[model samples]
Target: MNFQKPKVKAPSYELIHKTKNIIDKYSVNTICIESACPNISECFSRNSATFLILGDICTRKCKFCNVKHGKPNIVDSSEPKRVANAINELGLKYVVITSVDRDDLSDYGVSQYVKVTKEIKKINKNIKIELLTPDFHAKKELMDKIINSNPYKLSHNIETVESLYKNIMPGCSYKRSLKVLEYYAKTGILTKSSIMVGLGEKKEELIKTFYDLFNCGVKQISIGQYLSPSFKHHLVIKYYNKKEFDELKEIALDIGFDSVQSGILVRSSYYADKM
Candidate 1:
């Protein structure tokens, strides 16, 4: 009997005990676990993790994302306390908070983001908060308020090349995302963004995207492979080898990015503490 063809993707890793304990104690949600990110164990074992705020359900159904897509729960007003408690309990000096696109509420669920950051800061004066926010509907003033709150290292992932934006990240606009990065950089924030490979993006297109990001004043960048988390998402076009990833890094640095993380399993928050 013939078996169905096997799909190629990174194998999953075991859980990191310490990180599990922290999550259990404070009830924090992580993108690594919800998204099934392959780098979960390594990052968690090192006590480096990215928090997924606004609950696990996502309002927007992006094909590339692994988070649950459905109508989300009502706003948990006390979530900020729990998030702060988790951060304090983990003793994380550096922390990242990302949320699903919650167009369900007015302000696009930004007030919660602001409240969470403010609460976390109140807990630790010196904690570094990095917010990977949604587009804020591309309104400059809203984006301005979001930035004026002053989180360290503002990042909004562009997610993929321009050609695939329509099909892959429909809720996002390539130009709008670059503008978000540029807006933060212009305001004296250390701005950053990320892009994914293995989405049918050509090398030439990747180079052009790099230049576009540099022109937008992005200082840090992350490049990684796009492995499908489920059968519903777009098929992986190709996975770049380790050498290819290094070559991409060399080109990004040569193009004026201060820091660039390029690897097969790299995610927006992978090894984020070193940045």
Candidate 2:
């Protein structure tokens, strides 16, 4: 395949104004809003969204994400209750909570992650909790705390193929991420991860990633298109069409993923009910 700029589709999704209003009122951050995710409408309209807790600002800057970076805002003690309340009010059954990278904190914000998940469980123990976490650079102690919290599933994204890690996510190492996922898998947790196409990944490399992750014992995978959030961010290299995504989903299933959510508009947490 020739390397050329991919064509971005016109944004066609719609959001329920009330959903935005409530989130704004609660001061919650979300990938849907913060990242301009294409599936925001469909996800939010269905009362599904990944809650961005702690604060909106990230300490590390990733080339393909839209979450604001620099000095992170203060960690709000009130934030956990607010997020849980919003989940209760919105009547969400499966809630995914993520956040801006907060490496400045000594514990890498594990305290806040624990509090948020604990509060959500208090509101509804049956609520499926999925966490998309920072690399933590494979800190065993931090990983222990997060896993001990008993999330329904744990996800640390290997966002691109191994070769492209540094250029795409400067603060994260591909090995560190895989190690995080590997720890969860070995501990009998339902481990999950995500990746994006259109970031100059080759077909064989993506296939290799599936087997690599499977060898780590992960059971869930999410594949989505990589659209640059802005010109300053990473540029899109190729946009695999719907048929290509379908082929990948089949390949992933064949490679041993118990579940696969792969599509043009798919995000790590979009239509997450599949897993």
Candidate 3:
């Protein structure tokens, strides 16, 4: 069955331009632009963005991701301060920081997250900072460093159901992703995860994935329709409708997720502050 794509309101051109200028001034990266996020205009118009630290290049070639994969650039020691400056100039009260999968690094780029969080806090102690991170192979010592940074929330997306892992997220482990979230949750951190639908997953499989996340202590979750980035990327096997998104949200809530955002245009960090 074919489903119509939902409509999104146009973003303000003036606001978007202003936001882009600031981003350019700092010479920083954003997942919004790097991944070609559908909500880029809206987010930019609001002067909000999820900072993409480290560099734009990723180490893993996840079939569903749009972030470029290959050997990444060396860690930019100045990136943390620049990102913090960008947030300060934007006058943001809340910020989300994420990075490309830098599996090439010794600590898997964990120190960068800590540095960015601390730098942001240094500028505005009250500002809430959320870190959407790579799994870091679910290492406790590495995770402990991020936990000590005291971010407002820590997120590691499960991305898709277990049955689809091998094909969709090669070199990533479903069980290890759960262990990442579980570790943060056990430490009393506000841990979160996200899932993408329309990858030919069975409804039962999604529910099972939701339970797996909840059992491992994910308090927040987002479910969104999968749109193929290019002809070369994973094909979108389905386009979930409004009713289906609502059903998923209801199921997630019933399963004890404190917060749930499920819809056609939802992304892990889309409207993250509000979520």
- The prediction achieving the highest TM-score against the true structure is 3
Per-candidate local distance difference test: 0.85, 0.86, 0.93
Higher-TM-score candidate among 2 and 3? 3
Error of 2 at 155 (Å): 1.1
Note the residue pairs that clash in candidate 3. none
Off by over 4 Å in 1: 1-15
lDDT (Cα, tens digit) per residue for candidate 3, span 1-275: 77876777898888988899999999999999999888898888888899999899999989989999999989999999999999999999889899999899999999999998989989999999989999999899999999999998999999999999998899899999999999989989898899999999999999999999999999999999998999999999988989999999999999999999999999999888987
lDDT (0-100) at residue 18 of candidate 3? Answer: 86
Give me the overall lDDT of model 2: 0.86
Worst ten in a row by lDDT for model 1: 1-10
User: Model 1 over residues 94-155: C-alpha lDDT tens digits?
Assistant: 99999988888778778888899999999997999999888877778778777877898789
Better model by lDDT: candidate 2 vs candidate 3? 3
| Model 3 misplaced regions, further than 4 Å | none
List the candidates ranked by TM-score, beginning with the highest: 3, 2, 1
